[model samples]
Target chain A: MAAAPAPPLPDFEPAGLLRVRQGFDLAAVDPRSTPGFDGGKDEGERLLAAEDEELSDLQERLFAQSRSGARDAVLLVLQAMDTAGKGGIVRHVIGSVEPQGVHHKAFKAPTAEERSHGFLWRIEKELPGPGMIGVFDRSHYEDVLVQRVRGLTPPAEIEQRYGLINEFEAKIAAGGTRILKVMLHISKQEQKERLQERLDRADKHWKYNPGDVNDRAYWDDYQHAYQIALERTSTDAAPWFVVPADRKWYARIAVQQLLIGVLADIDPQWPVADFDVEREKLRLAAS
Target chain B: MAAAPAPPLPDFEPAGLLRVRQGFDLAAVDPRSTPGFDGGKDEGERLLAAEDEELSDLQERLFAQSRSGARDAVLLVLQAMDTAGKGGIVRHVIGSVEPQGVHHKAFKAPTAEERSHGFLWRIEKELPGPGMIGVFDRSHYEDVLVQRVRGLTPPAEIEQRYGLINEFEAKIAAGGTRILKVMLHISKQEQKERLQERLDRADKHWKYNPGDVNDRAYWDDYQHAYQIALERTSTDAAPWFVVPADRKWYARIAVQQLLIGVLADIDPQWPVADFDVEREKLRLAAS
Candidate 1:
């Protein structure tokens, strides 16, 4: 069969078409036009369901292929605005692999010990072996995203660190790792509704941190920071796919597709054994 | 709905049943003799399905509840014989939670760095925090399983190590963390079939090792060791369940049940936020 055409991508506001497959139009996925899809609302759910099934099958193949030992390990770094479902995407995507073959590292606040060493010190040790996949829920990118938005580092230093991240990733690639970075971009109003949902339910109350709302107030700064990070860092080695986060399910499906693509390239196969010696012994016994 | 009684386990070899569920009767399960399932299999499968759905739901609920600052983390430890699907069970069971809320650490052969510390040193740091579910691919039990089967450690010292592990895990539980251990068991013929399948496929060539075969030679020794491990380690604080490995789907379902039972006991409800400031602001806006 001939190769199929790529999906069309959504229109970019400024630096859009992040994943830019042929037919997928992320640009047209405006929240106001179809806010909170329901059975009655029926906002193209049928279209997505058909496409998601195809992607899931492709993902299973990638999952199967990535087990080969010769291939480079796949590393996915997920960064999202608050309430953008970063954790949700991480769970759904990497959850299928053999856990031995899939390693997950969540980068939290820089530890006193971690701060004493180079930023990559703690991260490098956690890289997945050739037969495995490693995922960082919040990764080394935080050094750029959070540090930049909070002005933890000076402008000169921030500009310098971007180059540092690029070089660090280059070293990772040179050592046989494929990296896919995703940034979940949720809109302001969607954030409001999600936060409200948490507050409305007693079981979800703990998720609504007041500071998160304060952080949401600085949504514009965070977006600009994302823009710079994406512009400066998106490269052939590790391209950034800024997934639309308002529709959480779509974002998850998109991330899974990207991961399936990366893992398919890794070639996950089981190793064969040298059975000649045992075979000879068994033959001798039979005779 | 009324809670169902514990599900009836499948007919197992006396040894397998004894090692697994503690009290399975071979006579009761012999398909050649027994005319009917007695609703045991159906009930077990139903409970398994229920448990899977419940655990999947709980994973999301826990992820959101994590911000409540309650360290109600569930630590799942999979200990079993080779080809038992310890890794496979994990891949399918926790497949839904986002990677951020779930941390997977697979303890491999001790690196020079890991061996330098006390045996459990590398494992201790990787334990899950409150709100995060840490899935250990092969955990501290390796000190007991691999090292024993291979005669890597002296028999004299193995006894002390067992006590030490119990004490170590006990302390972890006492500190408010919950632990559930699943031991995956499969028949010898089934294991050989799985191995052969791996060898026949070029893609799976990376998984079969001469060493795994070497270890397979001592399948009886390993089985005895596992029986001991299950008998000794299945405590109230951290119980070990021997799961059937001939069917991977069943094992995943069983594991999800164990997790829901353990995590639910922690009563993983979200902590209500003291949202006085936001409520006052919203009221002012309304006024």
Candidate 2:
């Protein structure tokens, strides 16, 4: 009999395709393709459901380890255009785990006090403690993205932030935080559809912002800013993952998988009992 | 034929049974009773499941309103003895909603810097922004509860904190935050059972702090402190609710109901579109 045909290889590994490697070009990555995930939408949903239990378990262990004096954590930084499904990723992926272990900060327009200090001042206060899973929805990158695109900051200062961000992330990584930066890449066409959907539904009206249209006018500038940000800040300590976000399901699953991969690498274990277990058991039983 | 007798009213409406009223006595509340809720453990679980959709919807509306320039927000202050299920409330009740709208702060022992400032200074910084639900898993009340119980602060100063807390809460309440202060009341027997459970399970050993046992020795003192805190600070602006927390399911549902009630009261409305919808539709279609 002829030898059986070789088993087919799985589609793409999202970690590799999404990661910002040297000379990575943002324009080259298609926002609609599910690069590493071969499965269709149904498959992605199924995979996300399957990973829920593991994610919960890993998060609990990480929290337990932190309570036992471990200084390791995971920080997920999410940057995306309006209606690019940042909220969906937060709700579907991070929402699966215990809330006790997750720290989420949605950075909005800076306050007067925040503007007076260095951009990272407020951010440093929100870093996850040991054993935490921190999610930053539009983080320090905003200083470079919007400020650069809109000409709100001096060019020299904007350039300085890229270096500052890299050094800051490197210092935190050295302190045991596994940083995963994700940019949800949605096509302009997809964005128009989403924006239209927000307008079409009365219930979604509150989420619609007239300013978003103004921002859309500067789309090219924003994209160029993102390209420079990705090139400058995707260091070894904190790598950026350009997630193809046109399909909400694929983006959610890919982000979940990325988090799971980092957590598995950390492999937090439950701490051993500090007191004598047998003695405590006997004492408790007697009591 | 005689008409069937009407069903009896449920004794404990968690919203009413748990809310602090004038001359409230913490000692009178039974930690094990499911007040106003005629549900057993299974019923509590089912009710919680039933409320999940509404809770999520309310939170989303609150978040949407906040984003659309509504200043209204809800702040849930969780104060409990060790293992009283503060974490469980966060996970089961608040966790069901979109994480983007929930701000959770787990206040640990104060650092040297925090000690240098007034207690509320640190707390003021963490207050939920407009349109967010902030959960304090142990809050400024700690300054009174632990500090008073342990005599960490002078008696006169501890006495002064209640007035300061009320003033601070009033200031914020006037600014649009609706505060719900919940005190999880568990029986001494229940605490012992919980503490013993931690000691028995190796996986839970990390949560077993020997200091918790030491704290147990001061249970009566802590109760006395809580009684005073509840009596003094349970104002109309920011009332305290003492939920019988021995039943984890009941406490979680009750807290959820409390939050739902507040959001319902606020009645956040969807903002009208600032831009001309018809024009945007034509513009997007043409684009």
Candidate 3:
């Protein structure tokens, strides 16, 4: 009998379709397009569900290997506009894995103590340990994005931060950290609808901030800042993927697939036993 | 027509059935018994699944309330011997809720810096924020359990720690934080079986430490130390619940029910909007 042909791989590889390449224009990408994914929302959900067991298994191996002195990890940095569903990605995609292997930090405004140090000081403190995945909900990029848009720091200082971030990420990558930078790209109109929904429901009122409306007024400046930051910081060592996030389900699954792919590449294996297994088994049975 | 009679509540009330009461005897409590819960393994799984939605809703409300200046929070402290399924509870019970709303800290050995300070110093830094649920995988009780049994600390200092723990818990409770302490009680036989299985499986070797066998030799000493710690520290502000953990499913569901009951008691409500609703609706529509 003839050998069976290999099955086709899933069309969820995000590197080619979503990655920010040289001279990439953010304006050219459509926020509603589900690039490289032929599936609709239902298919996206199914694919994501199918990967749950594999994700859990891979994480367990990674954790086990770490205990045996493996130095490998993945850092997923999430940057998005308000109401762009960063929290949803965290809850749906990252939360499905083993919690012990996941380290998450949400960076809010810096304290007086943090401001006393360099911008990268806090970021350095939260890097994931060996054989773990670290998630930054809003990361060092915020120093360039918001600070640039609001003029919180000087123009020269803001420009300096892009170089600092690139260097910082390169150092981390050199230490066996695979950095996946995701920018959840949502249109201005979609943001308005989301904000309106928050206003329409009483339970969601707490999520709505009046300041978001003021921030919305600076949308053009923010977008410009994001464009420049992406251009300056997107490197081979740490690249950015602008995921179309208008469809929340698609965005979630795409991110999940990206993570699964990275982990598959790493291919963490279960460590071999150091002791004589047969002898230990006999001893255990007797004991 | 009269309304139908309300359904009976599930009998897995950890507060009543498992709480370490005055004059509590750990030796008398069977580690194999399911306490008030009459459920089998399948029933326990069903009940845990049923509580997922309610747990998520209550947590969202708590998170929302916190944004509006509500100071209420819940801290679930889990103390268990090795192989008693603390990781299982974290993944199954606590992982079902919003990741953003749940703060988890797994306390391992104290670092040199942490050992330099008082025991409570490291713990204070990891406490749950207002309107969040914090889960402590292993907690300050380790000072009494491991320290006393291993003779790591002086007897006088160990005696003083019980009082210190009570006072620390009381101080936290006074600041709108509700404390729920749970001790997963697994039988010695079950522990032996678990450790044996770990040794028999090559994949599980990373989790097995030869030191665990040495620790097993002091099992009775650890038990005696635990009994004293539970009896001395079980107070109105922070009570300890000793759930039979030989059955992992039952222990998980019991812990879930305990968390749900505490959240139900708090009954966090959504905050009213500070901004004008109708005006924003129109403005959003116009935009």
Candidate 4:
């Protein structure tokens, strides 16, 4: 019997294809579109498996460089609605690397103490240290996204947050942080099916939030909020990628490719030994 | 030709075989021995690969239970000599689960502020919240281990820490935390070979600490310190497991199995729905 041929790799890069540019229209993007990737589910998974090792190696080099006082770091900010696969990206993509080198935070609604300070106060505390890959499940953008959609903040106050976010990101970028902001874009229909699955499965009940269903009533409002947030805050220092996330596998692979691109660009090298190697070897032998 | 037959699984559980008992002799245990496991390198690696999925699932369930107000959590505390594979246990074993659910802390020398407070004060702040798996690369045990060996603290003060640790762990255990302490035991000859390999490889240079060779001068003192600490602190609430670490693959697999046993005993079930499932289904259909 003859062997089967190998599958072709995705030719285009997700970084260029998925990045939100000036006048980018969220309504125009089909949630089901795979963008740069042409593969089906099985092939997408296979490609991810192939890329995982390189991702692991690159992250280790970044971590190693940090120990020698290198300030370079990568911050991956993931913003999504319910059932949009933010948890999946964390588990499958960031989870591929050494957990010690990855700093992950999943932000929730503010507490009384957090609300007393500026919107970015809590976020500034959790930024990744040198050579670490920082992940934010949802971030400071909620000031404009949910707060704006629900009219929880004044119109003027919500409007000012965009420029403030840009300034904050520029400061972080100046400190040698490479920021990749991603918004997992899933359609209303897709979310309905996903939410329904949660309701149906006995094992998935804890994940089913009744508030998520109530949020569905304001679907168009949230989408408008997202479009405006994407337009005003996406800058050269921190660009947002609107990933079509209806196909769970496609979303994961695209985010992984984006992260791999960021690390490769940093091109971190292992730190050279500062001490004398021969002396250390002789010293060890004596011990 | 037919496919190769599957290898047989190891018969004994690592949890029982590796736990440190009363009057435990550190000198009698062989660093090269693979107790409760008859497998060689290839089989050990294969077994870890096979067990990885179950470990991940068990972790997810534990995380899920926490969402429903469950107080249960697991803490894995790792103590080891230099080049004894503490990093390997982290990357290969705990890294297999969701990074979000794993709260990992690698303690360095205490800062000036940390030094001013009691030693346990800093450790208390970093304990994992409900439904999380906390990993300490080097933990409270270091206060006794390194501090005792170097006489950094008064011998009278060092004597008090062991009782403090036991009381602290028992209080934590009463609050539904399962503590698994592991000491990665390696031979001094094996340490020399590992340290030499690090010095030879340019890529491994960053991991080579010159201070490690200095520490080896105090090897016998350190081992004696470990013996006393292990004997005093290994209680039923948080028993210490002394894992043979000369074989890296065996060490990784044994830790994984021990973690699996802990999670399985907890037997976290998927939480039942608090809201009406039928009404939610209908509401989703309307949306």
Candidate 5:
């Protein structure tokens, strides 16, 4: 009573269920920047690169298992404010995957064609086939994230879309798809720093867009939209993971863990060898 | 008398060179199958799965351009016995390319890791990155095709030690990489029938391995090793593209064309905005 009850604690657990989160920070593995190369430095670099490579390799194998394990597929959705390292994750984290097995679908501003179809139609076209992985860059969630920030959708409509997403995602899950959404969370200040860095690299200038600054102006509104998105879409069938973005290495490793966890659970095995077929054939030639 | 030495036919450009090459068979494109969807209807199918969605998308864009440009990169390195489709050029024509930048890289036995470092230690290093396209299903070419054919690289060298490949590839090909290598020119009989099918899939499979029916007897030997490999080493960086044994149509299109051959000279605008000061400002704000 004397401390005025601390404003009732702000109700941080909007969904009311506390998840036991295992920390995953992909950036922790960075080789920190040792310049000189000759002996030890070279070895250190190789070792770190090798460690990253092995972990990456494991991530890839697990992803395939998850993709092909069940009748349904796994859908990874990435959502983030500008300047977050989404592209970087794709470059290093999943860089080694074969082009044929990984499906990447980017959801740009809705086109008249996309609008003619239901919100999920374009997405449906891009869904991973059985035994494949699909990634939605700036996916269906944009209906909530962008529309809300731009005042293009009413609050009531925003709520409606969220419910629709939940229903659609539930159907996907029930039908066999594993849906996991990831929102890369970078602090507004961190984003500002990233944007500036982009300006610094002349070669990277093409990646810069003036529109990003305008989006920054409404930071608070975007935050509220994100908060609501997290609250509404975080279900067991398709939970949203808010990845900490200050450290990119952590983000990638976390994504890998999620993949490993999902695939390890899915455990897709090579189809049963024909009863008569020899499983392991050996040859002694390529010397 | 009738032939005053015929000018030596200008050296015939070495094995399998003069014969027109089938760019890539296209009938394999199941327009309905999205980019990542695998058409493989077999238990032995394999591929590398990726985590980075953005990178995957960029690969598609790059592939599309690679296939379109004059200097498109469609490096075909075929390694097989007598009947493989290497010489099935006219029948396996890759029509999508604009008739320019396609190349090839062929591998021969090691001079040494060819003895020392490992089997793949050499080829593990030659992949094409980002814009330029490079294809190889049996590259780092030894581990199987050559290793199993000639009793060359000791057993232990080919066995358990074979799995140490993932790390080797992670470091090759600077960042953005897209690779697809196909094994064409198949079976000994198919080889003879095909020779009638037009001088026999070019008989170039001999250039790399030369052994013949002697090599064919070790078919099971080669297959088992290949199967194990197709199962284990197909990473995100490199995945095997198994063209159908019967039709080059399905096989060529599945490959050669996936490179996207669209852009010849990509002039990406590099941003020149002042960045250091802005970065400092953002850094201060981030605090």
Candidate 6:
């Protein structure tokens, strides 16, 4: 029998290809595009499932490394508009790791105390400790996006936040925290469908907010704010990836691939035994 | 041929059967017993897998109810000796739900600040918020366990904590948190074998603490301490369940079943739409 040819592999890397560079244009990107993934929904789902063991192993190694006093960690900062699948990414992608390894925060409208402090102050407090995967459902980027679009802050102040955020990210990156910032890009039509579905279903009614539609009135301004934020803060210390969110499967797989890439780069080893193995074996045996 | 008879169900409820009642004897309980589960490792694993969707649904309902202002929540408190598979329960059973809905805390030896406060002070701060399933890998019960075993606290103070814990638990339970405290009962032989395995595997060494074998010297004292803690603090407001954890699969399923039962009792309903669905539909369409 003739030898079977090896199956083709995905030629491009998601982390590098989907990454935002200087002069990145939000308007030029397609919300439904599945960049670098040549798979349909079924194939995408299968590939994601297949990546589970590697993802799990990598996560556990990172966690184990932390126990041995390695100070490396990962922070996944997810920013998106309402109904843009941030929660889906949390559940499907980040959910694959040990819950113990994840520190999740969903930043909401600033509380009185939060508003009293500098924007970066609250953001600094929630950074992941060594060996953790910290997730921010909506993050400090909101200061630049919603604060700019809604006139919540002065134009100068909002403009200043971009530099502040870059400095803050650089500090953390230098401190051994690998930052992955993702913008889940969904089209306006997709948002309408999602919001409509939420309104239609009694079970999903709790997730719908009247303010979300009100915010939709300023969607263009928010997009402009995002464009500015992306252009200013996509730095070498922490770059952003714009994952098209119209296809949930593609978005999830893309995020998973990004995480896998970052973890592989960290390449945490299982810490070598700090105690004498032979003596400990005898001690444990006697115990 | 006659139709086959329906497969028999496990006659007892693990939650009810394993509950630590007054006068419960810790020494008499077999660590290897399967309790209410009538299955071997493979069947137990399969059954646990089968319960995932139901567990996921129940958890989502609890989370949805929270968003709609329901105060209900669950706090799963796990207490065990070394290598008792507490982490396994977290990874297998509790890990089935959306990560956003779970708040996990693994209590370590008290820091200087923690020691300065009352033992229950730190515990109170980490309780699950509305709609969350909070997990404490080791809990306030430790104040009674290791503290008692090692004489870390005065006998009078240790004796006093049981009452304080009951009062604290009653307060929370009254405030809409369902508490499920589980003690993973593993035999000394099992612990020895598990410790030996950890010592043998380089990848597992990070998890092995030298203090673990030292703690093993007082294994009997720890059991006695657990017995006292169970007898005094396992009240109607917050009961304890002694799970035979020699079989990791059984321990996970028991905890999973306990969670399912508690959530079923809470019986969180999907909140009714607060706004006019038709009106919102039109608004969303216009947006």
- Looking at model 6, the pairs that clash are none
Using DockQ as the yardstick, the better of models 2 and 3 is 3
The C-alpha TM-scores of every prediction are 0.77, 0.87, 0.93, 0.98, 0.49, 0.96
Evaluate model 3: give its TM-score: 0.93
In terms of DockQ, which candidate is strongest?
Answer: 4
Query: For residues A1-287, what per-residue lDDT tens digits would candidate 2 score against the true structure?
Result: 55555444344357988899889898998999998777787777777777888888998999898877899999999999999999999999999899878888999999999999999999999999999999999899999999999889999999899999999999999999999999999999999999899889988877777778878888888899999999999999999999999999999989998998899889999998878877766655544
- Candidate 3 per-residue lDDT, tens place, A1-287, comes to 45555444366777778888889888887889899887777778877777788878888888888877889999999999999999999888888887878999999988899999998999999999999899999999999999889988999999888898999999999999999999999999999999999998898988888778878888888888889988999998899989999999888988887788778888998887766667666654554
**lDDT score, candidate 3, position A129:** 96
Best by lDDT: 4
Q: Taking the true A–B contacts (Cα pairs closer than 8 Å), what share appears in each candidate?
A: 0.50, 0.58, 0.50, 0.87, 0.13, 0.79
Ranking by TM-score: 4, 6, 3, 2, 1, 5
| Residue pairs of candidate 2 with colliding backbone atoms | A12-A36, B12-B35, B12-B36, B13-B36
RMSD per model, one decimal = 7.2, 6.1, 4.8, 1.3, 20.4, 3.3
RMSD of candidate 5 to true structure, Å: 20.4
Instruction: Decide which is better by TM-score, 1 or 6.
Output: 6
Question: Per-residue lDDT of B1-287 in model 1, one digit per residue for the tens?
Answer: 45555655553222223233454332233212212123344554664555556776676667666665666788988876567787666656776455566777777899998888989899899999877898898888888888888888899877788788889889989987888777666776677776666655655554555455566678778877776676667777777766665766656655666677676677676556678746834632332
Kindly provide the TM-score of model 2 when superposed on the true structure, using C-alpha atoms: 0.87
Candidate 6, residues B1-287, lDDT tens digits: the string is: 45555454443358889999977999999999999777687778777888889899999999999877999999999999999998888888988798889999999999999999999999999999999999999999999999999999999999888889999999999999999999999999999889888887888899898999999999999999999999998889999999999989889888889899999999999988788888888888888
True lDDT of residue B2, candidate 2? 55
**What digit string (tens of lDDT, one per residue) describes model 5 on residues B1-287?**
24333221111111122111334233332322323333432211211111123223433344444333323222344545445554333112321221111222345556754567656656646555334444343356456556755776577766654466655544452243434444443544454443333212222111222234346566656755655555555555544454444444333433433332212123212224433546544543443
Better of 3 and 5 by DockQ: 3
Off-target runs (Cα >4 Å) in candidate 5 are A1-72, A278-287, B1-287
